[model samples]
Target: MRVVILCGGESSERDVSLASGRSVAGALLDRGHEVVLVDPAAAVPVLAGPLRPGDAIDGFAVGKEPPSPAARQQLRRRMHAALTGGPVLELLREAELVFLALHGGWGEDGHVQALLEMAGVRFTGAGSAACAAAWHKGRAQAVLGATGVPVAERVLWGPTANGVPEAVRRLLTAGPVVVKPVADGSSVSVHYVDSLPQLTQLAAEMRSGEVELMVEPFLSGREFTVAVVGDQVLPVVEIELTTSVFDYTSKYQPGAVSEVCPAPVPDAFAARLQELALRAHHALGFGGDAYSRTDFRCDASGEPRCIEVNALPGLTATSLLPRAATGADWSYPELIQRLMDLSTR
Candidate 1:
């Protein structure tokens, strides 16, 4: 099958995206498929590498810069041009399927899915609405909470709202709260506050924008991630961060953390976590043939609380999803092929 793996974006996860693209492309090539790796942030360029029976083509570089008004506009222009231009659109027309590996912002938040839908292109992962719902932590939490899924008690704080005082009250009641940006990913602007005084100071230091914030009681338990492919759950991977919490730096940097695949949890608890992960995925309208990584916090009672779901998780060699897949006896190349086949189906 001729596949196009879209990766790299203007989000803070650009580096992560590139790593994912490389791994995916290599895997596809190893599986005897024609592959094109494109960076949606840059202009589509001709991809060339040694051609073999299972060799993949890494093409296209989409330009991306730091998150800024000007940078966003530039990225939009580039995407519009790429999708409407000769090489990218032509490739889409010829390719059998698209393997979307892009992370954060427009990539993971449904913008790219909408574009692919408009172009009548079949791509991997959840559709636009699901992507949008999952990308916004507050909205996803609302949906999960309504369904009786255990989530951290959270209050949304806006820039111009008097919610701060009420939020402080909640923090006082639920000490050790985590403050996170509602729309951001990769833990950008996520901070742990041990007290109301620290929360107040942190809120004051936060940039005044229309961006919403979420204050939730910090769960004191182990952090585990469940990777789901189709209806099958790979394995639970425990994330051990060197820092106080798993922030952006700890996420991408190698050796900053260690992931124990299968999570060293009991079989019953692991099964429960997998069940909840599938529930969270389907509840968010991600029932299609795609992959997602659901995070959880297991308390002393051995119950897991859903944290957040990554619709498009990192595919780096050491990424949680791939790590779990590897533990399931699926090599990197085999995993990529499985993803491609699933997308096409």
Candidate 2:
């Protein structure tokens, strides 16, 4: 089968997406499938023609900091023009299937998926509707919560925070609160703020014409995540945070946080995590053949609340979903193959 692996978009998680694309491309190539790696955010030589059987693509290691908002916007404009008038479209047209290794921004927010669907192509991961709902953490959690899944309550601040002071004041009544971007991944710009002064200060610092934030009561207990592919629920992966919050820096920084797969929890706790993960995945309308990862954090009473679901979870080396798959005895290549088989089914 011919596969076009799309990655490295103009999002905060661009590097991580590139790393995922490289991993998938290599694995499929190793398994004797023709693969073409394309980075819509930049120029890649392979996009000049049809899918090729062998192409050694590398040097896409993740960076510590994501591109600034200004930079990302600029890149997005440039990339949009390039994709509309470049050979990348040609490759997309010729490929038998497209594997989306993208995360965050339009890639994971339904824009790209809708475009692909309109073009009549089969792709890996969830459909456009699912991606849109999953990208917005607050909306996704609300859908899950409405379906009887417990979730952390959140107050959103749209493109421009309408009432920052009011939101902060309300969230402070519940002790501490966590602030995060409304539609981003990899925990970028996430803050666990305790006092009103601190939260106000953070809000003031981030206050801009395009700031999208959401605040929720902080859950101090353990943080857990699990992946679901089709009907298979992978093992639980526990996150051990090193700081007040698992911000983007801590998430990608080595030794910043330890991730334990098949988490050292009791049998019942593990089972609960698995059950909730799958529930959150399906509650968000993700298809069975697609894959997703759901996150949760326990409250003071040790009861877990669903946080959010990731439609296109990372496939990087240190990513939690892949680690869970490894704990389930699925090698990296086998997991990739299984996803491909399921996605094209």
Candidate 3:
């Protein structure tokens, strides 16, 4: 099979996407598939041949300042030319499938999937509507709650004046709260506010964006995540971060957080967690052939309350999906193959 692994999008998750792409490419190659690793931002001139291991290309650098408008336009033209204007299009046209290893923004939020769908290309992961719903924390929570899934009590802080203070009051009424942007992942902008003063300070500091903030009661318990692929739930993973909370650093930094696979919870509790995760996934309109991850926090009483559902979960080497898949005895290649197969069906 020929596979095009799309990675390194113009998102905060670009670095993580590159790491995931490297792993996905390696796994696909190991399975005897021809792979083309494309970083859309770094579209370069015609290559002598397909990129080989350690091959370098110019016009792009990850985690750096993005190119100016004109530079970006040129890069886009080159990428479109390379992928759709010449032999590169022919090459991609021959691909058996496109494995989207990109995260955040247009990649994970359904924009790219819509483009590929219009091109009649079969790709992996959820559709645009599901992606959009799940990516927005407040919206997804409402959908999940309607399906009887237990989500944390939350109030959304929209762009209107008085929204922030109202949300803060509601959350503080319940106790310490976690405030985060409504449409963010990787725990970015997530903060724990223990009092009204802290909440007000954080809210004031976060007032510059159109992105709404979400204020929810902090769940005091063990943090766990469940990965679902085509209705099958992988083992639950418990996250134990060295920091007080699992922020962005804890997520991407190796060893910053410890993941206990097949979490030490009882079988019944684990089963319940998987059930809730699947419910949340389906409630968000994720049908068969899509993969999703649902995060939860189990109180001391063993009741697991849903946090959020990642429609497009992180696929980097250290990501939870792969770790859960590994616990299920599925190698990286097998997992990737399975995901592709599921998506194309």
By lDDT, who's the top model here?
A: 2
**What are the lDDT figures for the candidates, one per model?**
0.77, 0.82, 0.76
Instruction: Give candidate 2 misplaced runs (Cα > 4 Å).
Output: 44-55, 159-167
Q: In candidate 1, which residue pairs clash?
A: 41-62, 41-63, 42-61, 42-62, 42-63
TM-scores, all candidates, are 0.89, 0.94, 0.86
Error of 1 at 321 (Å): 0.5
Q: Write the per-residue lDDT of candidate 3 for residues 1-345, one digit (tens) a residue.
A: 767878766566667777788778777766777678777656543222254445443322233232333564555555455544465555556678878887876677777777677667777888888888888888888888888999877888876666346656866886778888887677877898887777777777776556588888777778999999998999999998666567877887777789999899889888899889888889888889899999998665667788888877877778899999998999988998888888767
Candidate 3 lowest-lDDT run of ten: 57-66
Q: Which model is ahead, 2 or 3, in terms of TM-score?
A: 2
The runs of at least 3 residues in candidate 1 whose Cα sits more than 4 Å from the true structure, single-residue gaps closed, are: 43-73, 84-86, 204-207, 300-302
**20-137 in candidate 2: lDDT tens per residue?**
8888887787777888778787745353223355756564667899988888987698668645656777778778889898898888999888888887878898899999989998
lDDT of 1 by residue, 223-313 (tens): 9999889878888899986665678777766677999987887898888888888889888988758778899876656567888999999
Mind sharing the TM-score for model 1?
Answer: 0.89
How well does candidate 1 score on lDDT at residue 56?
47
Clashes of each: 5, 0, 0
Q: Model 2 — TM-score against the truth?
A: 0.94
